[model samples]
Target: MTRCRLCGSEALESVVDLGATPPCESFLAADQLDLPEPAYPLHLRVCTGCWLAQLPPLITPEETFREYAYFSSYSASWVEHARTFVAEAVRRLDLGATARDAFVVEVASNDGYLLKHVVDRGIRCLGIEPSVNVGAAARDAGVPTLTAFLDPATGAAVRAEHGPADLVVANNVYAHIPDVVGFTRGLRALVADDGWVSVEVQHLLTLMAENQYDTIYHEHFQYYTVGSAIRALASGGLALVDVEPLPTHGGSVRLWARPAEAVGGTADGAPPARTTAGARGRVADMLAREKAAGLQELSGYAEFSARVAKVRRDLLRFLVDAADRGATVVGYGAPGKGSTLLNHCGVRPDLLPYTVDRNPYKHGRFTPGTRIPILPPERIAADRPDYVLVLPWNLRTELLAQLSYVHAWGGRLVFPIPELSIVEVKP
Candidate 1:
């Protein structure tokens, strides 16, 4: 029996199956083309005991993140998000004149997209990044980064060197770890008595209710709910004092946690509320709603898979029809969820042609499994494809606004997931 990673519960149920896929960031090299690509079963299961949603075990961190190709500096929206988060954190923490000299550390700090803002204020910031390539990029950007994973041992080492941190920020990387207990313990060890650890992860309740099974890749080991997160933190001697909901990555939750001994505060002192109720209360309502919507029924997921297949058929027809009419169809945003959608839907270069990304590291590389070449976003403006598929559909509004220039050529934007639709731009 597969035990729960958080609560050691064996009462688990298979929720959704994403089929076999390669690691989203495993871009291929030219010489490695002939080698057989490694694919693993990508399935999600929910622990009935603690209500923690997670994927079945297959790959390890060493196998997944040794030389990670993803860099956070690529996304314009993400950079802005980080900058805003730093401003809020500094204000909420009440760090005034000392803010310039206060210590801030980020776990799984991919390329220091957020930490750079902290350093810009003259604050002493440190980044713990496991991927050597990504860590080196952060160092190049003038952010001090340690090339190692955040574990109990590593956390102790960091505390001995840099002392306790006033702020510990980990964004989007919270759900990618397998050892939930160890990871939380490391957070407890590194944080100061009054310091807070902020974690942002995609909310599980939203993923299931919205049919966002494409986010069930191997790298994301766990999907969190407020209840599950609170329990996990308490078990590791940490307290979750506040939470905030964010619209990024479909739907996500940003949690503010401090040592168990620290006193808690009210919602007014926390980040802006994104839901009608507080984070925990909103999560409870969502969980109850999901159960009422038959989330536990396996047939619900079967129907979801059917909807996905229909999307694939409709999108394929559109792309092929466009190509026959002498129009080029390309894709935008090479995100992890986009990789799952592209590979599972069987989209190849013959159909989608190529994809463009803002990340320079991924510009010359090919996506895993599909092997479709990735180019810089400038290629889209130059090539002027008749249709550009926005893979990260949640950011449709943001992406459309940025790529509005496509309307200059009478080109349209296409969205595949949650149904295939061609957007009409208002002149």
Candidate 2:
């Protein structure tokens, strides 16, 4: 655990620490409230060798994802993102002319949010999900799914049963795995020689730059940069082909890869992504930018911890001031990120009352550590609180649009991270 996760180097430096906290997604029911909950050290480190930021495991994945409350379908914007991604992949990958039934595989495919789009296109798809409850939901929706952790062995079994995939989609899962090497190598086994592998993860540069410490939790084991991604995927015999920055999850990057052997790899080692002239130019530019920003050195992380500490004080001050004025403040979205923000700031129901979420799984449960009640989004209008704190600030546009009725009651929206500010909603 002390060694760097990507390069296995002994040269690792501390980045930021959130102290001991419960797993963000570990919400509790009324009966379970009486029981003790576990907490672990929440720290991040950057490898001096590969420059990848990561959190060493204090808990196992078995304990973290045994039962999951997140359902992607609950977010209308996320579903639309999936739908558009499918349509583009279909056209760009030449799946229609190549074969309308191109084989597609998605790892950590939660509730078939993206795979359902593949199904609608008549493309053959399989989901490798570890969550038992969510996997059942995917199955009921007519998507073939397997309940297993993906490694080289299981990935081989998947390709054997269902023909080799034309495209292997791993959206936002690279950061959740502890074995970065094994999981990326598994992509090679699950795909055909000429197939493509796509992985989307929150960019580490954006995380520290934007003060997105809320995204830090036990469920996410690693943070990625373009530099680290190349090393991690290459270790698994895959080569990065292309990279695109995305707006999802505050800021993210979608990486396209292919088997190393297909891109002129030697027996000794695999080459990096096959950069066409333009691709090579862009990759070099990005690496240069990261290096210029001191991302490759330990000094780069020095300012982050102090910035995060100030954020906690600022948010607490803002909320406490609002409560003193006798203004009611309720929350929107009981997201995992909200758990980190609430628990870190020592917020209870007193500072912020109940929150709301569209996911019915979390309706009756309390957020981990902070025992704030969760209600449906309808309550925001019913209560018509003076202020509605938007917890998932990354989706402010979508949340604001959906809860447009809040403006009717003269309710203003508040954002905590990056900075504490009030957003005026317009009809």
Candidate with best lDDT = 2
lDDT of each: 0.80, 0.86
Show model 1 residue runs off by greater than 4 Å. 99-101, 263-307, 320-326
lDDT of 2 by residue, 1-427 (tens): 6798777898878888788889998889999988998888888888888888889888777887767889888888888988888898888888767435689999999899999999987888999999999999999999889998899999999988898999999998999999899898898899899888989999888888999999998889999888888888888988776777889989998888888878753322223445476665666666666777778888778899999999899989988999999999999999989999898889999998899999999999999999899998888888899899889999977987987788898989999878888877888
What is the overall TM-score of model 2 with all chains considered together? 0.96
Poorest lDDT segment (10 consecutive residues) of candidate 2: 264-273
Residue 330 of model 2 has an lDDT of: 95
Candidate 2, lDDT over the whole model: 0.86
| lDDT of candidate 2 at residue 374, scale 0 to 100 | 91
RMSD of each: 4.1, 1.9
TM-score of each: 0.89, 0.96
lDDT of 1 by residue, 1-427 (tens): 3899988999888766678999887888777778999998887777877777888768888887888878888778889999999998888876445524578899999898999998897888899999999899999999999998888898889999999988988888878888888888888888888788899988776776666767778899998876677777776667666667788888888887877766542222222233234654654555465566555444434456566567668877898898899888899988888888888888899988899988787877888999999899999989988889998888877787888989888888998867788985544
Quote the positional error of residue 199 for candidate 2 in Å: 0.3
